[model samples]
Target: MTRPAAPPFAASATDPIRSILMNTLIAPETDQRRPEFPTQQPRIEVVAPLAPGDEAILTPAALDFLAALHDRFAHTRHELLARRLQTRVDAANGRDPKFLPETEWIRLDPEWRVAGAAPGLEDRRVEITGPTDRKMAINALNSGARVWLADQEDATSPTWGNVIGGQRSLYDFLRGQLEYTSPEGKEYRVTAERTPTIVFRPRGWHLVEKHLRFHDRAGRSMSASGSLVDFGLYFFHNAEALIAQGSGPYFYLPKLESHLEARLWNDVFVFAQQELGLPQGTVRATVLIETIQAAFEMEEILFELREHCAGLNAGRWDYIFSIIKTFRSRGRRWVLPDRTQITMTVPFMRAYTELLVSTAHRRGAYAIGGMSAFIPDRRNPEVTERALEKVALDKRREAGDGFDGSWVAHPDLIATAKAEFDAVLGERPNQLDRLREDVEVGAADLLDIPSAGGEVSDAGVVDNIAIAIRYIESWLRGVGAAAIDHLMEDAATAEISRSQIWQWLDNNTVTAEGTRIDQTSIVASMAAAVAALPRFEGDRFDDAISVFREVALAPEFPTFLTVGAYARFF
Candidate 1:
């Protein structure tokens, strides 16, 4: 297949910038090579040079499909992102978020139910999650879990290679051609009798793919939306093959803040299916209820995507980060304790999960639980024993609380998580019949932040700084998910770590040892943390510290660390 020609650019003094916190500015004008214009029609130009394997994924037809999707929905996506900023400002200015009065009818009319699970998604007892690198994709497919969350969102670093290579990985996975060989002569391939169902997660709408620039009809040029690029490429290339294999083009939508966003996605699905001549409802999507704003509009979101909705996943890590980010400017009462202190058993988290289960089940959707980030280590039997015990307890609680399935980061914990769900759902694909009508959650329950009562210790504050620095360094090296201190750390956990630092500094939080969390103390802790880490070749500690300070210690807060980091470093 021939590659698409680079599109022409109108002369400009500077590169265009979408919202800073959302789409972010792309590469500066002087650094890019200009190609001659082919035609006046709206076009997409590949700014980054194609790498070794990118030819397989970035064919001319695939780029055309991406341009079509962006042209149809880019305007609405921008409007929705602007609305998100306004909503955040309102929350900071004491306009508390309550259930929408206008949408009360949607909630009151209980007859509506989402399109249930598709063929392979009927029983998702154990779902494994990881980035879509070739090795991880192979391991996840052969992990014996019912589903593999081929994550490109929080779990991916968004390097130019990863962004395109991930799609290539999935394209190869569906064709049974994914395999990896280590330098030590160990070979890894998909060898399981029954592979897991594949659920691809594209990046959130807030991100922009700077490697590709889109020129609209009016001759305005900006970076392409990451969400559209990821979804467009994957669906355009693999939708037909997946459907023929009895698995539709299923997805897990991340970081949706409102029902309107869900509605926008529904429109995208409708338009894409029509463009491809597929059935209207051939796509299935599971929305991650990761934001506080989304938790309030669960039923409304379900209603909007009813035709293509699969269920909701409790994105617990991002949910915590959302709480801190939404209420960062508020008084100390809205401040949460250390991340270690906030468990699912806390009144507020419990309220959120219970409400999620009841809300999803009431609307005839599967209710999936949060991830257990603990990865068992065989080198130390004691560590493995403790990790398994902790994972078992967490899974048991989720299964007993009416969750159909739960997520595990590593393959070792799949059996434990599946065992818990299996004990509760014997000979049954799911527990959609167990509608937890008893879960009555009010606005006050979800906002009960003070109910999570635990003192902030000096250790907690220091750990936040350490984890943020470590994870940011790994991200800078193009690795999104890193095993840190025996736990799987991703962008969500790193967001929580950095957000807590900002929240603590804003609120003058005093640790249990009478030490105040101020700029001085945080800087000292960061320096110490860096010194403690073992140095490796090509490590990004210096850049990581600079990025961490800009996001965590600055006077103004960035909505997402990845947004700015990606724009600047990647």
Candidate 2:
């Protein structure tokens, strides 16, 4: 197939290869030039258009390093992913997750501790997360929060442009050359002293970067693992620079299910460090204990990566989605209430968070709280005040309960969340010292879904359908995080919304209004929601509806809506 012409902006750039790469649209193509490598020469074909300035990040050295990573770890990743499937099936079949008897000794051993926090990460009281686009990257780095999660996972749509463009943004940010100019003549740049620490979040193990392919033994092209592609590119390009700037290559691992998965990541870290001639433990990672299975193995996860571990994070939305997913086939007892009703204070959620804090502290690691999804509405003081108040309450709970820090989706909420943490921290950096030995939880506590009491409502169902469609539409447009109804909705939130609809319909869940949720009600609600939405040019409302319905009403629930929806775009 003939490649599309590069965008005008992309062509005007100084770099020749960048112009060529950016001019070529992403599609499956055969590799014409075979390059030599130190050990192996895996065939790599890049189909994505290299956006303007992307050449600086996608250098030959970087691509070679990425290929080396794939050569070494791709096979292990495939095995671990297969293990995840078998484990999920076992969980759904009534084999509840608990602390592995084999790994109990690691938890009991009190002398072991995770490597101390790297520089720029010692005081992460308030961290803001967003996609790694130019404007958002500049804004987030300038935000007063202590850390900025440069997310390439849930907060990113994984479009060809996004995958390459995001790397360019991060590359520029690390080099202190990232800047953006608004149409209104406002210029944004990272302030040296005030810039938040950068911590990258790569895509999860389950995802595959279809635009980049590696040849297998049979000479058939296979999609490269998303995790390796993202992490490899960033680390290969910027690890040395970050280390020189008084910080190491920091990362946040997402959607990990077991300590064994964590072990795979640790092995990758070790290999990457050795490959680049960096010292051992130069990379620091914080694991998001999002999956229900992971919650049961926090200590073991930390233990596996102790030399490279920084902390643990309370991943809220995905955690709820995991609960629904693992127990989808198991009847009503496993069914959760409305997504809105499943707050952190619920018995099961509280148990999860408490356990997380205790586990992190016990292992001498930071325990970061969940994201406060409330985006500030500046037009209405009442709305802003209410949102801030709720945020304050949530932060206060986290701080009081021995959390080291927390996350906020918006820069506006930083002060509010910081103040709450400040009140409890009071000049101290973190609460890792306050080990909550008092908290004891069992499998029942973690699985106590029936205790989160609230009935499904028609409004709740409509909200889910509307948000899922809206978010997916934005995702199709290459925007991962969307501010809708005064809340920031990302892939995680969309997953929870759609998965809840699936679970509800499958269980014949009745709303408080004495109505049973079925395909007919869902169809009506979907139509009504789409109609109520204001029309926009080139909006993918229809596509979003189709994707949502397929995932929510399919005979077998898809692992992730993005897995199926991604094909529509590429």
Candidate 3:
């Protein structure tokens, strides 16, 4: 039986006007003019202190745009988040997700294809991912990468300053006005010759931007969705400028679990384009197939966003985290090994990437590969060499598998990644013509967790604890993309660390040395993890430890560590 059709934006049970507002705002006007705003503008309460330059980005008009976005879509976002919890609960209860029968037509229909590469995104052989701070922005734009993932999600700690400052950096960069000077008299500027196509990644639907509160008509107030806040502010401020530059406001949509979520994003794109008086398909988005559930619905997701879809990215780190989280309660078979052991070549991971490439190519979309997290340390030649070798190997594998491009966490690895793609792609912008047809992946192949074939280790547990603590400390200090032991660590990697600990403890996993991973053992390991780190003057180790323990040791697994951390601390 087909699932019942419902309005794209349903009214909240408590807020009847939500549906009316959504219809009025999202519905294309008769003459194609901008949608009329509600009579009483939704009150936007700024809770965080605005820095001196924030006013340029958060103008009255921009805030009004943000408020309208919130008022129209916040209710639907809430529903989707609640649906996520219920789906996870169902998965925990053994209702494992399969390819949707209702959407079988979407998968089987072979003629449908996503909107092919936008102008600047034609040759994305090496995309660099980083936070949008001034120095990093300058370095990334100069990194010789084909694309720069201006990340506001995993790579950015959601401090108010970081949020608004990130927008300012992107705004100035587009206008050729972004530059920085160091205390030691060093200069950094964006050289237009080497600048990459900018693809912005807003936060996922699960997070809230506490700095901005949206007050409804009846004086009801709630935090705005971080996804809308990030997307709205950037689109409102820079859409026209990007268009004038012959590129659109492209995006990397992250952590989507189902095609319905993709549909919502497609609608948002449509509404944003209509509101901004641009063409319907002007904005393009690449969906990250990072969750296990999303793997099942890849074709459907592409179909959902066909008009505005750019392609699909293999978000390898978070994909592993999603597998662990979805099946955490399903017993020992679901337990994962060390984060380092879960490479893209593992059986399930290989299945995921292979399927991603095949599915994307079949749908006429770009099949981007996963990130190489090995950031080179310039001081240590040996470490840098190892990183280069590791990155080359990974990128070579992806290119061989017919991937159009891949991601690198650091500028140093960009050449290593691009060289592999260049060896395969040659003068061609992409290998989209090399459709990978022999790939056949089933649900069982994707769920073959035991195929990973590595043992849980004492050292692995210690590393998980230590890395989680270290990364959390960095996050608390307003640093998101942190280099720990020569590898770039972000929220996705940290999620794997803490979630693995919880899975191990919950399942009574015994290490290879026969030590049962229980609460007592975890406490002992926590001390070792803490002691191993060097002390700094303004470290938030105490709070970091508390946050790690709370999420990792909770009876019920937290959907995302960042959600609670953002709520309680920031």
Runs of candidate 3 with Cα error greater than 4 angstroms are 1-42
Q: Write the per-residue lDDT of candidate 2 for residues 1-570, one digit (tens) a residue.
A: 232332221212444443343233222223423235534543666767776677787777777777767666665566556567667777778898887776667777888899959999999999999999889998898788899999999999999888888988888877777888999999988875778888999999989898888764334557888999999998988899998988879999999998878988998999899889999999999999999999999998898899999999999999999999999889999888888899999999999999999989998999999997788899988889988999999999999999999999988899999999999999999988899999999888999989999889988988998899999999998999999988999999999999999999999888999878888877787778888775699998888889998989887899899998886665
- lDDT tens per residue, model 1, 308-338: 9999999999999999999997989988888
Q: What TM-score does each of the candidates earn?
A: 0.93, 0.92, 0.94
Better of 1 and 2 by TM-score: 1
Q: Deviation in angstroms for 439 in model 1?
A: 1.0
Rank by lDDT, highest first.
1, 3, 2
66 Cα displacement, candidate 3 (Å): 1.1
The most accurate candidate by TM-score is 3
CA-RMSD of model 3: 4.0
Q: Compared with the true structure, what per-residue lDDT tens digits does model 3 show for residues 144-200?
A: 999999999999999988999999999998887999998899999987585799999
Candidate 1, overall lDDT?
Answer: 0.88
Cα RMSD of all models vs. native, in order, equals 6.8, 9.8, 4.0
Ranking by TM-score: 3, 1, 2
C-alpha lDDT score of every prediction, in listed order:
0.88, 0.86, 0.87
Which stretches of candidate 2 lie above 4 Å from their native place? 1-42, 183-185
